[model samples]
Target: MTSPTVSVKRVSECFVKPQHDHSQDAKQPIYLTPFDLPFLNLNYSQKGLLFAKPPPSENQHFSITTFLNNLRNSLSATLTHFYPLAARLATRKQQNPPSYVIYIDPENSPGVKFIHATVDVSVSDILTSTYVPSVVHSFFDLNGAICHDGHTLPLLSIQVTELTDGIFIGGSVNHVLADGTSFWLFMSSWSQIFKSNVNENACFVSRTPIFKRWVLEQHDPITSLPFSYPDEFIERYERPQHLKERFFHFTTASVSKLKTKANTECNTEKISSLQAVSALLWRCVTRARHQPLNSETICKLVVSNRGRANPPMSEDYFGNPIGSVSATTTVEELMAHGLGCAALRIHEAVRSHDDKAVKTQVARWYRNPVVYKMSGLLPPNITHIGSSPRFDMYGCEFGLGKAVAARSGMMNKGDGKVTMYPGREGGGSMDVEVCLLPEYMMDLECDEEFISALIEE
Candidate 1:
């Protein structure tokens, strides 16, 4: 049976420029850090949707018109601090040597695009659906035309979709411009401004973004290393579209149970909830795939380096401060060692990314600046996990109360890809979204161990 499709009507589209002018640094190009280069060829954006129910009282002045006006105004104000987001990427035309640079050409560059849309489907219809709804994809502006080339695309695009019961504010930010933390920081700030009714004085000063690009730069001159261009990596990393996405909710109690089980197996060290959950999923997904016993399987864990910087970079410091750490084991070992072994491997891989290690890695990349070859080539038996359950996505409010739920529209949705989100109620509960080929998904659904771990909502 086919799931119902929501009809989305675009009401308006316009570019929202920064309220303040930043022409002084217009000609200067923000050079891409070695960390930012891997994302250059990847036109994919980080898409998030925040859903909020309508105002409670009829006497409330918060109508859709007022809400949108406030959002537009607030976004304009917020962009002043996040000016780089309003700019575009400048790529090398033939003879240009440095590859690509972000040009803050306020005069000619197109600012972030703002779109107003309406969906006929109600919010409850979506929340109650068994499968991941297609409407969630429509909420964001995922147009290929807008994100085809790093040079032409706006660094950010936002769509405000109104429904019968609530509203969905969808955001698509260029991956090169920011990481998950930076993205959420911008979002939280936007919500603050909207909640304050666009009052300039009410804007939180402490949350201001630092736009200095050199903070991540090394003091000494670094030797240039050879790197693959976006064209060379496109086909290798392109996600397969023949997979299905499903959301599995795990309550705090279930998470504790998994953690306890994993710890009991590994007598020396205790693994985190994140590691435990990843281990469980990794084991289940790998088994579902039914690969050869000797085949090597890898779980690519995305680790945030915010706290691991030598001096510890400020939590508010924007840009990508993230790196991938992987736990590798043979299929036979992974299946035989139980969840504790996999969890321990994951825990250690993450623990190894301490301050000194993270700093050393950054410096090494600086001297030999190049995108990792592992990024584009995900051979069979490999999975890349992005996002974290720590982010307070459900806490974001915009005058209409807190968000009921959140989901990623632009995350990689191919086989062995996973993204995690904090549960709506937000204790230690988690929402794990998994993507897999139909056969593997079918196997996963039938696995008794996997089914037993899930906490049915």
Candidate 2:
């Protein structure tokens, strides 16, 4: 077997001081500290070794340090972006540092640490492609371990090769901090930041998060942790072996029609487009399990608590929003019901619940530590939708070439798989990219009639 090239080394570790919020300004958003917060512990990792090439350079070479320096400066200016809750689970002192390595001892680690190159593709051809095939290949595996917690950072490497355009940009991120939408937003910003001409066209500076924990508590004063016992609902299923990715496109017209139907069924004025899709996906996942359709068979739904928590956080912070909503329903409840019924139930469960419930539940979980035990209560199929960074219009222009297509990479956490919701053009509809078991998706795909029904006419 051929040996690999490329190596990573940790240069230094710094003692980061903790920053506490003492601001009593009622106008300023109260932000929770990710460092000291409980319920932030989760493990995210995946490995996929694929092949691709970097962008081409006719007369000039791409500078790696320049890009890194730009990224640093961007972080410095947007300190909240780097230290935001969604991006970093831990606070200042607890924050994880991005790993930086060089090819000092490539021959030592062999293929395990270094990428095994096999393919005769030229460098220029690779870079010139609408999207760098190399970067696309890198997205398949999540190298989240490079960060302190499970936060993500852009990974890049440049070295002169006999083959001219040989380069790679890759890294892994935790699923918690940012969904695919957040990832793209950060990437696009990072690219602009690298160029040193950060145009206002490429940044999302929100005044506050959409959902907060405190707001949620006020709505759902009575809340319970979604899990009952570790073995009760979690240990029954086997983990999936093969992971596959597929895209599902829904028309705006179809979603609008569903929205009307959902709103009517729920006896409400409005129903979110995502709530409608969630209903369909919930049923499909349940069917994959071959479980009898019933409300008793529970599945968990996650909702972002960005502005839902106490004191309402500033939308300007870029890290992670406290995620605090979990909804459970049986396969039967979803299967036997129409989209409206499902939407109403899902909406009620999420909307009625608030941050106090999340805070209370978080407090309980910390006392008992439910993540390790309750992962199984989590459905074998998980879905997250309605957040895409591209809408912010941050152009992802690195010196090489802009990203042609960027979506969340495959996420293999516990027993369940994940599906990401991203914005699609047109005022009325949304797009979804599902990261599920190959077998599960195949089963859905084979059912042509069922799949067709899912599409809006």
Candidate 3:
């Protein structure tokens, strides 16, 4: 396939603050919790959506200027209710080490970065590509930023890119402020305000967000990171060795089949769709890698601590309530026993990661205060899962049109790093975004069993 002429250039950029009077409590500082601290080592969470515009006859009020004005106005109105997003972070030296604290100050004011750009490429050019084009990465702001860098950068930045016949909306959020759940919540609220066009008095999100931050029992509020310097976390930003990122769409029926097969093979445990798909992927990737039978392989899944914690945080609690669980075994044990065995291992790890387990991990983090180095931490033969298929990704409509596809930023990239989203067609469907080494991705593509299980998109 020969390449075509493609170019991307920034058109405009500005800061958007809350529409209401935010000067009342402009200097309030919200301390991060144990649930949020480890994310210091990670990059800002960047996610985007692409939407097609209806014909001019269909939407007589539409224009390049009108579209930008609508989005800018709606985002400002939406920020009134979520004012924390417009704030910034500043470093606080606690004891000898440095700590981060988020606050909206009268001196610095409050605002979120909004960037508008145009690309000559069409939407089809993006969706039809074998892997996510590296250009999709530029559709967002804060290219290689770490969450800890929020002190010098905007706490949140949104980029709205105009495509040839469509539009791309991408955003980057400091993971310390909002996890995947909260990010979508903000997006949906912004969309709702844009569509309603009604009197906005704040409060439009489906669920009311609980802004009160969580603190581990007996932990100090102004806790400092164990690192000697903030740059220690930045060192982890080495580009993940993987060069290929593929989006695998698993139809609703195919997911059901995978789930059924896993449960049938393992009568003792009724595995879920996630566990089932993970099992299939783990086996396929391990087999494709052709690692020695005695080699060790690990499958890690990031679970929401919002529900699994001791008392369980509210679904509306708007901070990072995340924990992880991993299944470790030799390649021989995984492949010889089949999908059922692999799934059960994952299921059991997820099931056993109860409140006690969650607390234990938090406690350990508090003790050592070690942040995850992106390219290091996990083993080479590993599958690390993030995000979820339950998020209302497609519901984010901004009046111009609903979304047709989704893409993420340069963050969280590496071999076997996967993010899951509900399919655009709905009905319990799932889309798995996989990043892998070129050769391994080729092998996985050629794996007949893996390819046969997928639904042709």
Candidate 4:
């Protein structure tokens, strides 16, 4: 089969003034800041490169104007359906981060060229044995992937295949621009606009712009002590390559099964599926590493507060949700005691860093950018749960059929990295994809029983 050629050209008149609402009083509202702006807002980035495969047809080169028009319509339409905050982001610009999506010319290139443009697939009997790629991995890749650029365009790009079917689309977004949710909204909106269905009152509406420094100045009790970082942790942060990563997954049913088994064995009230799976994962990761852990051996879990906060931010908020770290241990003592005890520890860790703590943390960062900077420089061993949007919005209608594969790659962090998200087909359960070091995987592979637990029953 002839490879598909994907080329993008920037339309000169592509610029449009961002839409905004002027009804609110002009008096500076809450001193505008990045926090005020949706989180997916772009930041100037280091340069990188992008290349796509040649089109499958002989004369199927996509025109710059046509592609841009199509993209605008798709962006507009996508924003209308899933996230209304996109319009606000389009209008919100500070020192004007040099962030602009560009056109790539994948005229006649290597086979790898098209691979870069295409999505990934799941490795199940449904996809592999049948020679059909499942859309599950594609959504994961689109939502979690990042781009590296080093040319004139200089901006990361996330391309939806069409103006209507948001699935079967693939693109790389820059991490610095926004967190996962924020990035999704921007991409979705871009697709909606390309489709010419932009919502008039989307959530991307820019509130008064507030800089980070000013936000810190407004708060009383702003002088909180800096989050102390241990010297060893600081060293590890400086060496990105030194860290190890592994990817593993568990289905919703498998998790429930374990939860039931653990609950029955412990004779306790029901434990959350999340808690049960977390304890299992924590233990597995630690054992895989052949490391002896203790209560202080922490595993940080990232959960979105989209639907869990007191005054839940609008789905259109487009910024980091107000939340904090839920942590636990893989100590032999804890694991040996009983599943319920371990579940309780994990539960408390999550509850401990509630909304108030999260809000306070965000505020402190504004007041002390240095502290946030340091923490980011050295993030904990994070295990993101129920945060992967792979299957949640898989039926995205950017005009294309469902995606072929979805897998995320930007989470290059921590000793044992894992992200839990919904499985494809909303398959009545969730799937956790683990990315860790090869040595760790080898260790895990050595234990057949441990490895078997990860497979969906």
lDDT of 3 by residue, 1-457 (tens): 1144455799899999877766555446767777777777788999989998776577566687877887888888887777788877766655544444433332454589999899877888888998888778888999788887777788789999988778999999999889999899889888988887735564365666777766678877655675555666555576664568999999999998888888889885479999999988988888888999999999999888888876878888877888888999999999889788899999999999998888788788788876667767546799888899999999998875669998898787887888898899999899999888898899999997688779543
> What's the CA RMSD of model 1 in angstroms?
3.2
lDDT of 4 by residue, 1-457 (tens): 1112322221132312123322223212122232422222222211111112223472256453454455554443343332212211112112333222211221211111011122322123223332112232232222322221212222233333221112234444333333455555555454344444444644342222211122333564222222232221111122234343333446666766777866776676556777777777666666666655553345556565555544555555543443346555546665466556666667777766655655676666655543122225223443444345342344333433333334443334334556555555464455555555567766766656456666767
Worst 10 residues of 3 by lDDT: 98-107
As for TM-score, the candidate ahead, 3 or 4, is 3
Cα lDDT for residue 177, candidate 1: 64
Q: How close is each model in CA RMSD to the real structure?
A: 3.2, 10.6, 2.4, 10.3
- How do the predictions measure up, each by TM-score? 0.89, 0.59, 0.94, 0.59
Which sections of candidate 2 miss by over 4 Å? 1-41, 44-137, 140-171, 174-185, 195-239, 366-402, 412-416, 424-428, 448-450, 453-456
lDDT of 1 by residue, 1-457 (tens): 2245547899998999777777676435665555566555454555565565655674265577777888888998888777778887665433345332333344445788899998777767767776567667788875443232546767788998887667888888877568888888898888777676666565553487754453444453222234235554333345566677788899998888889889999885469998999999999999999999999999988877878876777778777667889999999999998889999999999988897777677677766665444345456798778888998676568776777778667344567888899887777999988888888989999987788888543
Q: Rank the candidates by lDDT, best first.
A: 3, 1, 2, 4
In order, candidate lDDTs are 0.73, 0.41, 0.81, 0.41
Model 1: what TM-score?
0.89
Summarize candidate 2's per-residue lDDT along 228-310 as a digit string, tens digits. 33223222223344555555666767667767777888788756877766666665655665665543544345555545666
What lDDT is reached at residue 12 by model 1? Answer: 95
